[model samples]
Target: MTFSDVVEAVKSLSTDEKIEIQLLLQQYLREERREEIYQNFRAAQAELENGSLKFSSNIDELRKLIQE
Candidate 1:
């Protein structure tokens, strides 16, 4: 169906049903994004643990990189 038809169908739902659907969608997406962020953080932590991560101790170089 087209976007307008989907919207019209949603508009026909009761207020409580619409709210519940919206909450469910929000919760589902939030959980998905949270999982993604957690996975990325875990990968970075592993890199640090394996001595594959690098850091610059020079303040000037850090500042230049941040600006870029």
Candidate 2:
């Protein structure tokens, strides 16, 4: 079904069902965010292993690194 159709169907749900859907959406968003973080961590690990990752303790150096 289309997004608008799904939205219209949700509008017909009872108040309790709407609340349940809100909770489910929250859980799904959290799981998605967690997976995104894990993927980024894996990419960073690969960069570190390949000697392509750079680290800095100075603000000016960080800005220069980002510009590159």
Candidate 3:
């Protein structure tokens, strides 16, 4: 079914069912975010290994890098 159909179906759920669905959706979102973070860390690690990642020691250095 389409998103609209899913929305309508969820709207017809009982209060307890809605709460359970909300909790499940929240958990799914959290897991998605964690996976995204893990993927980013892996990319950063690869960049570091290839000597492509830049590190700044202080605010001035960070600003200089951003300006470039």
**TM-score for each predicted model, relative to the true structure:** 0.64, 0.95, 0.86
lDDT of 2 at 44: 99
lDDT per model vs. reference: 0.92, 0.99, 0.97
Q: How accurate is candidate 2 locally (lDDT)?
A: 0.99
Give the TM-score (vs. native) of candidate 3: 0.86
> Per-residue alpha-carbon lDDT of model 3 for 1-68, expressed as tens digits?
99999999999999999999999999999999999999999999999999988997899999988898
Query: Could you give candidate 2's per-residue lDDT for residues 1-68 as a string of tens digits?
Result: 99999999999999999999999999999999999999999999999999999999999999999999
Model 2 regions more than 4 Å off: none
Candidate 3: 10-residue stretch with minimal lDDT = 56-65
List of clashing residue pairs for candidate 1:
none
lDDT of 1: 0.92
Which should have the higher TM-score, number 2 or number 3? 2
What global local distance difference test value does model 3 have?
0.97
RMSD of each: 3.0, 0.7, 1.5
Ranking by TM-score: 2, 3, 1
Candidate 1 local lDDT, 1-68, one digit each (tens) = 99899899989999999999899999999999999999999998998999975579999988876776
Candidate 2 has what TM-score? Answer: 0.95
